[model samples]
Target: MEKILVVEDDKDIRDILKIYLKTGFFEIWEAENGKQAFEVLENKEPDLVILDLMLPDINGLDICKNIRIKYKYPIIMITAKTSDQDKIAGLTYGADDYITKPFNPLEVLARVKAQLRRYKEYWKGSNEKNTIYYKGLILDRNSMHVNLNGINLKLTPTEFKLLEILLLNKGQVLSGEKLFHLLREDEYYSKSTNTITVHIRNLREKMKESFERPEYIKTVWGVGYIIED
Candidate 1:
């Protein structure tokens, strides 16, 4: 059974998730703070981590950053902060997904399952072409590696997926809503364009592409974003 480590301080929230995730048949580990979270990590490695941004000790962003240094497992950040900046901050720190407070338990469950599936698929490789070469960039699906101008660049799964999609559909515009739907691996739609915006910004920064005059992945204003062939 896949294990899930939930780092949440609120007992009620934790209990709610425990019940729902347990129903999903996942082995759940509970941690009320960053300290206990690390302790859990020391003893057992979970397949996915459900992290809360507001903790009694140790900010959740720091915990996510620390985890990224060593582990590549998927992380879903849960926080009461509803602002786009808050969500962007979480993503900037390497979180795979973000959920605001008052979120539906079912949505959380769905995201957890979606993340695990994507994580597993990333490691195992998919049926798509093993490698794609465009301009000075090389993306290898089998190895889950990307290189640009003979230099390797580390990318989060979300960033990698976005790049793959853009490359596959090069020279075409894809709206944020469309990209978000594709990323979620479901048809669920919400006014969450900021998620894609932050991710694309991250991708550009890693690629060293200038936002003002990008060589690739250019924004189309009211249309969407596209990568020129």
Candidate 2:
């Protein structure tokens, strides 16, 4: 059974989540504040965490950072703050998804299931493909860590996912359109957006490489980009 840890300040919200998600194949764990949530995380080790942004003790962003620092476990942040900046902050801090308050519990459940699916797929890549080697670099999805010549590269969650996609499809030309869709899923992306280019540039910079004369992500002129084998 997959375990779910729900961290919320409201007792009613916690009970509602348990009532809906506690199926025979899924066990539900609850904590009313960030302190209790961390205690549960230390002991129970949930498969996924549903964290409230407005926790009474310890900001939810702090909790997200702490979780990302040690573990790559998927986190779906729930908050009343629905601004784009707030949402971006959640993602920038390693949240896999975000939900607003007064949301449909059914929608929450769906997002929960979707995150687990992607999380499982992400880890499974390491099991099937093992380390992805290119030049002197090594990528280990299982550990959510990457290193070049034994030196770890400090990567944001977005950068890590972008690199993972590029390495997974090594030598195959991946269009910017495909990458954006894959990275952001069916979210608020549009054809006119150049988000992929920005992310690619950032990734290349971290690789100490560039698109003009590249060693890693090679832009195939009019054909998007590829990591040459």
Candidate 3:
């Protein structure tokens, strides 16, 4: 059974989510604040987390940062704030997805299912024929692991998928549209091209690559992006 943690301060909302998501396949855990959520995270590493931004102890952004420090599990941020900055902040802080308040339970469930599917595919290296390499950076399709400079770099599922795609088509330009399609097809998540850009930016940061003069992923002016071998 997959374990999922729900962290929200509103008791009614939390209960509603819990009841809606309850299934034989899922073992649900609940936390009312960020402090409690951290405790749950430390004690039991859930497969995924449903987080609310407005917390009593710590904000959801801080919680996401702390979680990203050690764990690479998928996180979905649920908040009342729908501003672009708020959404971008959540993504920048390591959230896998964001949902606004008054969201449909069915939509939330669909997003959860999509994220899990993508994580599984990337983590398990689902495509046996998809091995990628770039300038000594190797991504083993069988192992779902990335090796950079002959050293293994621990990557989150999202990071691994992005790198795999980029390295596979080294020297070939891929537009934001194409990359988004790749990710969406792999994970079943529907998102805009801007979201794809955000994920790529995050991957670049992890690889310690300069965005200004990227060696691996480069912008093709108005086209999109490409990997330079």
**How well does candidate 3 match the true structure, expressed as C-alpha RMSD?**
2.5
Per-residue lDDT, model 3, residue 60, is: 92
> Tens digits of per-residue lDDT for model 2 on 1-229?
8999999999999888887777435699889998999899788788889999889989999999898787767788898996867866776666766788888777677667766766676666443766778888898877667898778876655567778899988879989888877776645434333546666766676678855688888898787989887
Off by over 4 Å in 2: 122-128, 141-144, 153-161, 170-177, 180-229
For model 3, name the residue pairs that clash: none
Q: If scored against the real structure, what TM-score would every candidate get?
A: 0.93, 0.73, 0.87
Could you give me the TM-score of model 1 versus the true structure? 0.93
Candidate 1 vs candidate 2: the lDDT winner is: 1
Root-mean-square deviation of every model: 1.6, 4.5, 2.5
State model 3's lDDT: 0.80
Which is superior by TM-score, 1 or 3?
1
Which ranges of candidate 1 are over 4 A from the true structure? none
Give the Cα lDDT of each candidate: 0.90, 0.78, 0.80
Model 2 residue 178 CA deviation in Å: 2.7
